[model samples]
Target chain A: MPTIIEKIFQMHTEDKVEAGNTIWLNIDLRTARDFAGAKVVKNLLKHYSSEYIEDATKTFFTFDCNAPANTIEYANNQQICREFARKNGIKVYDVGRGIGSHVVIEEGLAYPGITAVGTDSHFNILGSVGAFGQGMGDIDIAFVFKTGKTWFEVPETVKVNFIGTPSAPWSAKDLALLCVKELRRKVLGRAIEFYGEIVDELSLAGRITLASMVTEMGGIIGFIPPNREVINFYSKRSGKEIKPVYADDATYEKEIDIDVSNLEPLIALPPSPSNVKRVRDVHDIKVDSVFIGSCTNGRVEDMQAVAKILKGKKIAENITLKVVPATREVWREMMNGEIMKELFNAGAIISHSACAGCASGQIGMTGEGEVQVSTSNRNFKGKQGAGDTYLASPETAAASALTGYITGVDEI
Target chain B: MKVKGRVWKIEKDGKLMDDIDTDMIYHNKYLHITEQEEMAKYAFSNLEGWQDFPEKARKGDIIFAGENFGCGSSRQHAVDCFIALGINAIVAKSFGAIYKRNAINSGLAVLECNALDMAEVETGDEIEIDFETGEIKKNGICILKAKPMNKIQYAIYLAGNLFRYAEGI
Candidate 1:
C-alpha cells in the first residue's frame, strides 16, 4: 500500500511514516558538485570543526558544472573541494567526468530503494532508475555529510499514465515537454509516479529525459518504477541480481492520463520551460546556436538520433552547433561509434563531456540578442545566458541546426 | 511569534507576479560569492523591473509575492540573498518545493496565504503576521489569513537551522 518513495523512506527509517509526516531517514549516498561543493565544505567545517563525517565512504564530490575550471573562481572552488576530499578520504569525480547526477548513475553509486542527496537541483533524475533522490542546499548537504541523514516530509504521490506510442520525429523530449505543459503547477510540491505502456517501452535514456524535467513542473520527484532495462543495467554493473520496486496497490492524491499518440515535437519558449508550443506553430525562427547536450538529453541514444539526422549534411552557415556528451562514459561510447564522425562532419563543435550550456561560462552560453535551441532543461532568463533559449529534442535541434532556424524534424 | 514589517510586493502590470525563479532572485553569475553581505547587493539583480531591489530594500522589510515564488533551481542563494537583505519574512500564495525547504532550514520565515492575490496589500504597507494564529493584519486591521509554519519548520526556525536543531536532538 506504499508508493515507491514511501517504501524507500520506510526502508531507511525505523518507524512507519506516511504523507505529511516529517521524519529523519538515513542516507545511502551524499554528493556535492563544483557549483556548491566548496560552500558545503565550508559550512561543514564552520559548524563541526575537524569532526569525522558520519560516513566518508558514502560521500563524494563531483566537478562537472565548470569542468576544467574556466574561471579563476571555479578553479579555486574545485581546489577547495579536492583538498577537503583528500583530507576526509572521500571520492572526487573531477573535471571532464560530466554532470554529477549522470555520473552517479553511470558509476552505479545509486540503485533502486536507495536514498541519495546532492547539491544539484536535478538530482531527482535518480528517480528514473527507481531511487529516491532529492536536491538540497549546501547547508543541508553539509549536515547530511556530517550525520549521514536528513529530515524529509513524505509528499503525496500523483500517478501519471502515458498511453499510446509516439511515432518518429516525436522523441522522449517531446513527451516530456507535453507532460510539463499538461501538468504545469498541478504537481507542485508532490511526488509523481509515471505509468502505462508508453513508459514501459521507453529506454533508460528516454526515462531519464522524462524524469529530469519533473523539476519544471514543480514536482518533488517523478519516479518511473525500475523497468527491465534499468534492472539489467545495474545488475550487470554490480554483478548481482537487482530487484525492481513498484507502487503496487498504492493510493494516489490524483491521477492524470495523457495520450502521446497525437503529440508532436514541442518547444518551450523563453522565460519558462512550461511555456510549451507545437513546433509547427513557431517554425523558422532564426537560431544563432543549437546546443545538443545536457543532463536532460545527452545520452548515447540522443547523440545517435542527432547523427542520423545530420549524416552527410552540413549545418547552415553562421549556425554554431555545440554537442556535449553527458559523461565520459557516454563520450567514450560515441567515440567508438560513428556518432562522433557524423556530428563532426556536420560541423558541430563537439566539446568535452560536461554540462555545457546549462551552467555558466561553458561552451554553449548564448550572448545577448542570440537565439539558441537547446536540449537542456530550463530556459529561464539569464540561465543559459542573456540570450533567449528554446527547449527542444535532439532531432529538432539537429534539424534546426541544418537550416539555421527553429525547424521541426518533420520539416527536415 | 508576531512579525511586523513594511511590504515589498513583487508584481507586474498591477498584478502579483508568479513563478519568480531563483535566477531572477539571484543570478548564476554572482554564485561565486559565498558571503552573506556580498550576496545582499545582487538580490533581484536579474529580475526585470526589480533590478533595483537591493537599493530599495531596508532592514525588517517583508516581501509579498504571488504563487510559486522561488520556482526554479535549488540554489540557496535565492533564500540567502533575501536573508542578507534583512528581510523578516515572505508571504506567498505558494512556493517551490525545494525553495520552501531551503527557507525553513535556513531559518527564514515563509507563510502561505491562498487569498494573497485578493488581499488589499501594497508596497510600503505595514503588516503584522502572527505565526501562532495564522493571522495577517494590515495597519492594525485583519486583512488576510495565511498558513503558518508546520511543526518541523517552526522547530528549525526556533533552533536557528537544521544543524543547530540536530545538535539539540
Candidate 2:
C-alpha cells in the first residue's frame, strides 16, 4: 500500500509507482514571482510563441518577493512581469498584493489532490491544504508552461506523528523548528507526512507554518492530509468539493513520534534554521529590530498573538518592530480587526503585504552591528541585509518586541 | 552528456565545507542581475573557491562539493551563474532539490555520487564524468560511480534543455 504521497503520484501518473521511480506527471497550477517569472517569461517567448501557453489562467504571476520595487533592477523585472502577464493573458498579483506562494492557496488555485509548481522553493506551503505542491526552478517552470508536464523521482515518505496538545508560547513555529532539528538532512530525497491528533487539531495558520518549513529539512513537501478541517476550509474558500486522501495503515518508510506538550517556545539562532534553542535559555541578547511576519508566520492568528502581547503597550524605545502581512486578504483582515490598530499603537512599523523585509530587507532593513529576531524562515547570514537574524515564533517575536532583547512570552 | 575536465574543490584550512548553500554560489547582491552573460563574473564571489574564477575558469571545469550543495533559496541564479561561467558539470554528495532540477532543465550536467570524497580530490585533479555510463574517474582511475539519470532526464539532457526537448517531442 502506498502512502498518501505515493498515492498522489500514482493517481497523477496512472501507474503503480514507489520510491526511486521516475515518472512524468501533468502539472495543475504553475506560479512565479517577479524575479523568476520575468526569466520564465523571457525563456518561454524565446522558445515558443505566446499561443504556446497551454492555459494562461492556469498560471499565476505575482510581484511579491521584492515588492514596492526596492531597486531599479527589481523594478525593471516587475515591469517585465507586468508586461508578460498582459501579453500572455495570465493573472498578475501586483506589488503589495500577496506572497505568491501563499496567495495561490487563499485564492483557491491550489487545493487537495492537485499538483502545483512554483518558481520559489516555499511552494510546499500549499501542502497545508493537502495539495502536492513542489517548487521548481524557473527554467523547469517555463518548460511546464510549454508542456504542462514534468518528471520527478518518487521519494520515500517520513511520517511524523504528534501525540500531545500544545500550550501557549509554543505554536507551529516551535514544532517546525524542532522538526528541522530532528529530521535535518535525513529527509533528503524524501517527503514528510504529518499525522496524529495534534496535527488535526492545529489551526490552519499552524498547519501552514509547519508545511512551509519542510524545505529547511530538505524534504520535498510537508503535508497534512485533508482532514475535515482542511476540506471544510478549502471547500468554503474555493467553492469546490474537496475530498480526503488517506495513506494505508503502516505504510511509511519511517515513523517518529513527538510529544507536543514537552515542547518549548523555540528559536533558531543565526546562520541556520536548524540551529534551534529554547527561547527561555537565551536571554538579554539585545535586539535592534523585530520583524514579525513572513510566509512562515504572517497569518491572522500570528497577528492576533502579536496583538495579545503588545496591546496597550509600546515597544522598546531601542527596538523597531516591523510587521508584514503575508497576503492582501490577511492585510485587510488585520486592518479591519484590532490587530493592526494594536500593532500601530505599539509603535510597530507595518509594511505592505508581501515578502518585503524577509528575503532582501526591502522595507525594514537591519543596520550595522544591529541584531534582529524575525519570524521569517531563514536566518542565514545577510539573508535580510546586514547584521544578524534569529528565527522565532510569532509569540516570541511579539514578546521580544516589548523588551529590547530576546525574551520569550514567559519572560514578558 | 559526457564531461571530461579538471576538478576544483572549495576548501578552508584544508577542510571541505558541507552544506554549501546557494547564497555562497551566487550572492544575493547579484540576484537582481538577470543577464545570464553577466552572472559568471560574480560566480563563487563569496565562496572560498576561486574569487577570480570568472577570469580564470575554463569552459569544461567541474565543481566537486560536499553534502547539500545549493541548499538555500530556489534561485535559478545559483545554477545559472555556473552555466554562465561555462562550468560543464557539478558532482556533489547531494543537491538541494531545486538546484538539481534547475541544472538538468538548463542542460547543465550534474550527478550524485555518495562516495565522493573531497579529501581524496584536490584542485586541478583531472576528472571525467560520463553521464551515459554513470562513471566518474579521477586522474584516469575510476574513483566513484554516480547515480545514473533516468530516461526522461537523459532525454532532456540530450536535447540540451527541457524547452528544446519539449519542442522536439
Candidate 3:
C-alpha cells in the first residue's frame, strides 16, 4: 500500500505515518539560498541568540540567490554560512559542489527518501529523486532549522502521467514549459508527480527540470518516483545507499500525461514561464541578449549543449550573449573542454561561477529595448534584464545569439 | 495582549506602496539583502515608509494588504519584519504560499475576503480576528469571514509550527 511518494518520505520518516492516504512529514533536512537564507539568518539571529536554537544540526545551506558575477557572492555567503555550519556542526558543502541547494542535496550525496525543504520555489526539484520537498517561507524554514521536522498540510497530488517517448532534442524541460503554459497561473499550490513510461527514461536532470518548472505553473515542485536511474545516480555519485521507492498503481489522486515523442523543442516568451510556444514558432524573433544560467539551466549539458551550437560560429555583433555555468564543477568541466572559449569566440560573455545573468541584472544586465533569448528557466517580466526574454533550450539560445533571433535546436 | 486597532495602511494593488530598488537593501552587487534585520524587514528594504512602521503593533491593528501579498522571492524576512513590527492580521486580496503558511503557522491572522474594504481599513482602525474560527471584525462590528486554515495547517498554527509542535520545544 506504499505509494511512490510515501516510500520516499518514509526513507527519512521510516514509519512516522502510514502511506495509504496523504501524510505530513518530519523533515530531516532543510536549506535556503543567499537571497532568502541571508535575510532569514539575519532575522533568526537578531533578537534570539543561536544558543536557543536546538536543532541547528539538521539544517544545511548553500550559496545561491544573488550569487555574484564571477560569483563573488558565493564566497561572501559561504563565509557566513560556513561559520554557522561549523558552529552547529552542520555539513557545509559550499567549497566545490556549491550551486543551488536543492540540486546539490540530490546530486551531492544527500540521501533519497529523506525529507528536504528549501526556501527556493523549485526546491521541489528534489522530487525527481522521491524526496518530499517544497518551497516554504523563511519563518517556516527557521522553524525547520529550530526543529528537524517540518509540518505540512497534505495537498491533493496531481499525477502527471507521461505516455510516449520524447523525440530528439525534445526533453522534459519542453514538457514542463508546455505544462506551465497549458496550466497557466491557475494551478498554484498543486504538486505534480510525473508517472508512466517516459518517467522510466527520464534522466535525473530531466526530472529535475520537470519538477523545477512547477514553480512556473504557480505550483510547488513536480516529482518522479525513484526508479533505476535515480538509484544508479546515487550509487555511483553519492556513495550512499539508495533504495528504490514506488507508488501503488492506484494511489495517485489524479493523472496527466504527455506524449514525449510528439513534443518538439519549446520556448517561453517574455512576461512569464507559461507564455510558451514551439521553438519553431519563434525561430525568427529577433534577439539582442541570450543568457544561459540559473539553477534551471545551469547543469553541465545545458551549458555544453549551448556550447556545441556556438562552435565555430561568431556571435552577432550587436547581440550580447551571457553564458554562466551553474556550478564550479560545471565551470571547471567546460573550461577543460574549451566550451568556454567557443562561447567567448561566439561573442558570449562568460561570467563567474554563479547563477549569473539570470536575474536582478547583476551580471547579465540587458537593456531597455533589447530582446533576450535565455536558456535559463523563467521569462518573467524583466527576469534577466529590464527587457524582453524568450526562453528556449541551450541549443536555441546559441542559435539566437548567433543569428540574433530565436531558433529551434535542430534548425540551427 | 489584544489591543484592537484599525488598519493603518494597506496596499491593494500588486504594486508596492514604496519603490523597491537594489540600492536600499543590498550592500553589494551580489543578489543578497544585507544581514541587517532592520534593513530587510520588508521586501522593499530601503523604502521611505519602512522607518515609519510602528513598534509593538497592537491587536486589532487593521493590516492592509495587496494582491498576492507574498509574491516575488520566497523570503520569510518579510513576514518576520511585519510580525516583529507588530502588525496584526492582514486583509489582502491574496497571499502566497510562504506568507499564508507562515502567518497561519505563527498564529497571525489574515483575511482574504472583501479586498477593497480590507484595503480600506486603515491604521488605527479597530479590527479583531478569532483564531479558533476564521472571523474578522472591523470597527467594532463583524465584517467578514476570514479564510479558515485547513485542519492540518491550523494544527501546526495552534502548536506554533513544527519546532514547537515537536516532542519538545
Q: Evaluated on chain B only, what are the TM-scores of all the candidate structures, in order?
A: 0.97, 0.91, 0.65
Worst 10 residues of 2 chain A by lDDT: A356-365
Report, for all candidates in order, the number of backbone clashes.
Answer: 0, 0, 24
Clashes in model 1: which pairs? none
DockQ of each: 0.81, 0.70, 0.29
Distance from true location, Cα of A317 in model 1, Å: 0.4
True contacts kept of 2: 0.62
Off by over 4 Å in 1: none
Quantify all predictions' global Cα lDDT against the true fold: 0.90, 0.83, 0.61
Could you tell me which 10 consecutive residues in candidate 3 chain B have the lowest summed lDDT? B18-27
Model 2 stretches astray by more than 4 angstroms = A49-51, A166-168, B48-51
For model 2, how does the per-residue alpha-carbon lDDT over A352-412 read when each residue is reduced to its tens digit?
8888766673566676678998998987766787678899998899888898889989887
Write one digit per residue (lDDT tens) for candidate 2, span B116-156. 77336688888888898778886677778888777878888
TM-score of chain A of each: 0.98, 0.96, 0.87
Please, what are the lDDT tens digits per residue for candidate 1 over residues A252-289?
A: 99899988878899999998999999998995599999
Superposed Cα deviation of residue A74, candidate 1 (Å): 1.0
Question: Which residue pairs in candidate 2 have backbone atoms (N, alpha carbon, C) closer than 3 angstroms, thus clashing?
Answer: none
Winner by lDDT:
1
Relative to the unseen true structure, what is the C-alpha lDDT of residue A275 in candidate 2, on a scale of 0 to 100? 91
List the candidate numbers ranked by DockQ, top first: 1, 2, 3
